[model samples]
Target: MKAVLPSITSDLDQAERDLREHGICLVSGVLSAEQLADVRAGLYRAAKLDNRRKLAHSGRRIDHGESNQHVRNTLSLDPVFADVAEHPAALRLVRSVLGWPALLGNQSAFIAMPGCEAGRLHADQGFIPEPWPTLPQGCNVGWCIDEFTEENGATRFVPGSCRHHRPPGEGDEEGSVAAVAPAGTMVVFDSRIWHRTGENRTSDQSCAALFNWYTRPIYRTQENWFLSLNPRILEGASDELLTLLGYKTEGFGKVNGRSPM
Candidate 1:
């Protein structure tokens, strides 16, 4: 595999700044060709695992007819996925946007149905009952494993939608932006931004890995990652990464009572 950058710098700095201001940023070619291949290999491996099954839960389920598959808890399934989850470019961008001391929350793989229709437009952070202007809570990184496009059901977002206090209505004339990129490009955006999965008009299933990050210590993650991790995975992870994955929660006292033991 190719060597990863310690952090994103120079032109990426400007791109990050623009994302912070607009509540969304798209970084093309963030994942190298080798890295992309590794991710694809890992995903295909996970998909083929007998133990790796589809989630029974239907709320987030996509209508795949015979092939609709939504796979979860991938971090524990393979080390290759763990590496991609903690990719340097993704980590650097998360830190730059949310400030230091962020952790991964709600990591999963989305394998969508070819003819699936559009999903409801809503902000991931809307579930939080707290008032506005609070510290930045979380953001999500969408790693395109396959080519994303309007025809293949790419994610749609409304620019500057993060500033809205409530979810957008059905009649709202939202300015839609499709996350169109080749395999390996990653899209990072604030959790507060309004977005939805677009309809898939093609025969191929759209696949992407979703990695969410948060600055606060105590919020419930989108995925229960602790229950999904194993000792071997923990041993191989970096100190910073271990903490991000909830292996060691030092500063988490601000949210969860007492440090994570």
Candidate 2:
């Protein structure tokens, strides 16, 4: 649980090194303030839209910090999100952990509203059976919008716990520390890491944390991009984004009567 925070200004090679050593690396200053502003605007708007829909159907809010919201399938929610999800540095880092042909496994918003409690410590690939700790199937990139202070629910992780190759039980987690960083920092971690959200102690601030998860091309993504993405959004997108959406795979979809490459 000791936090081994490497210098976020390290080059890509060092960043990748930290990922291997600690199972997570907080890359500071990856996103510019302007980029953060654009995404935050879109993110809040999308959250409001989603909140209204959820309110009508569930008669309850998602969480409490300010509507403690976790919005899955954010790739299609806003163009700014899409841009960040496919950012060059993030994709390169994820590909280092997953592979050159990695696909976008999932994208979502994890808003820590004030009073939002910590989530269970877990690996992103928490449910694959029998395979045990086979090969790694994922890597996650957290695009932090607001600064991640211990009091504002910064994620916490156990250093080098990925080597355990199995989930840590409640008794196993000790010395956990928060992955603290300023706003616009990008947190990249191996999916096998033992980590979870920490409690948001603030009374009025809601933290906006966006997660863009990637995995091998063969594994299924959490969000079905084909179904969720608007046709306009998909139309004429760059080849890279298309591939991340699993359009590069042969079995699941075909375009123009031929398999997408």
Candidate 3:
């Protein structure tokens, strides 16, 4: 199938337009079928490895132990996951959302299966002890690795909710919409928007690769990815890749110190 994306200039213009109108934008076919398959396989392998270790240590019998109550598995453990986390379309979307010079904060995955409970509705940065009515700190890219539908636990968001002084409530239900997209598609949204993972009703599981990039330098990430990076991966990565991975001179200025000129 052909890749679904606008040309670079068109994408930039469209992205800004989308952000101005809608709090989120759905970009389709960011990943090819082969790439999607590879990511899924890598996730499965990671999940299996974790499950095997859990079972071996617990000595308890379990059915489908690989699945979790909220998110089944995380992609941070997979090497190939780094590629998906730094995809070009994803970066463009981030630039549009945050107005560029953004820093990559965290990279992870969420796999939801049937019967999983619905996630709580909250903005990601809320975890930080900050003042109310904060500025837009960052944006997130949710890659639909599996087919996501309303019945299959698609992501739900309140459009233009980012403009609100605070998080939305039950009264904001009218504008909320479920972002149902096909596998290989991606949904990029403001980190401050009110959103939740919808409950999965299908028997099969729904998986998503979530990459969050921040506009500012001080924010903490959901995933401690710096520990996961190795020399091989770093050497092969581009400068943009390194910047996205939190390797920047500005952010480390105080710590790195200035030379005596």
Candidate 4:
């Protein structure tokens, strides 16, 4: 019901606590100024290239004039993207909720262009059947590349909605609040939390965030790394990166009843 989510500056312990209590939290100053600029530039460049290649994703709400452009292949576009994906605090929080075997489900740019309609209110786990389990099966880490404000379409979330154990509906919009934070903050939340992009009222500024989704190992990943990952990345991937990508199989993911690694 508050105007914004709770935030902690450079405190991993508080971040985990916030996630458990509020279902969402912002970790400020997670990225340096240089990192912020580089990642932002990489996102735009990848988006431009994808647009040119007709591979960009724009979810059009025709009647509502929503044309949010999403760049889905950021992992293959730049090394900076990869660097951000492995951010220590972000990954640690992810593992704390989803466990050490959590797999990186998807990493993409969530951009709200000018005049865009607010995104539909729903939980990230909406795709899965309800009544949901008490423990989260997945989580989202949204890296704010640009300072988020109400005017420029910061993401909106329903605090403590994770305990609802189900997806939100039409009347659930009343208590939602925008996640307004400075650039370089990482907005992390449980998959069951109700959230969506707020409307972008600004004429020129576009709210951009790199969203890295992590899931429990049992679920299928949103992005198919085997088919979509760049060969160069695979060739040089560390053991941890490989594990995150599902290339390093564990108990259930074994190939021919044997570990891939």
For lDDT, the strongest prediction is 4
> Stretches of candidate 4 above 4 Å error?
1-4, 57-66
How many pairs of residues collide in each model?
1, 6, 0, 0
Rank the candidate models, highest lDDT first: 4, 2, 1, 3
The 10-residue segment with the lowest total lDDT in model 4: 58-67
> For every model shown, what is its TM-score relative to the native structure?
0.82, 0.89, 0.79, 0.93
Task: Please rank every candidate by TM-score, starting with the best.
Answer: 4, 2, 1, 3
Against the reference, the lDDT scores of all candidates come to: 0.65, 0.77, 0.61, 0.82
> What does the lDDT read for residue 38 in candidate 3?
88
lDDT of 1 at 217: 55
lDDT of 2 by residue, 1-261 (tens): 345756575478888888777778878667788899998888888878878777412433333344357776777766777789889899888877877777887888878888887777777877666355655778999978888888888888877778877777777667677878888989998878888788898998777889988887767887788788766667667777878887764325677877586
* TM-score winner, 2 or 4: 4
Model 1 lDDT per residue over 1-261, tens place: 421112222357765885667766777767678877877777766665623444423354533343334556667766766776677877887877676567677566765567666766777676677565544467788877888777877777777777775557786435776777667767787777787777778876655545444554566666666565665777657866766766565434423655454
Candidate 2 regions with alpha-carbon error over 4 angstroms: 1-3, 55-67, 250-258
What's the lDDT of the predicted structure labeled candidate 3?
0.61
Least accurate 10 contiguous residues by lDDT in model 1: 1-10
Model 1: lDDT equals 0.65
Off by over 4 Å in 1: 1-10, 50-68, 213-215, 251-261
lDDT of 3 by residue, 1-261 (tens): 421222212354576667656656777656788888988787666656755666322432111233332223243455567677678877776766665456677665566667755666777556545455455677878777777778877777776677774755666645556776678777777777777776777786654545444555566554455675554666567666666656655432333464211
lDDT of 4 by residue, 218-256 (tens): 888888888998878776777777788887774138788
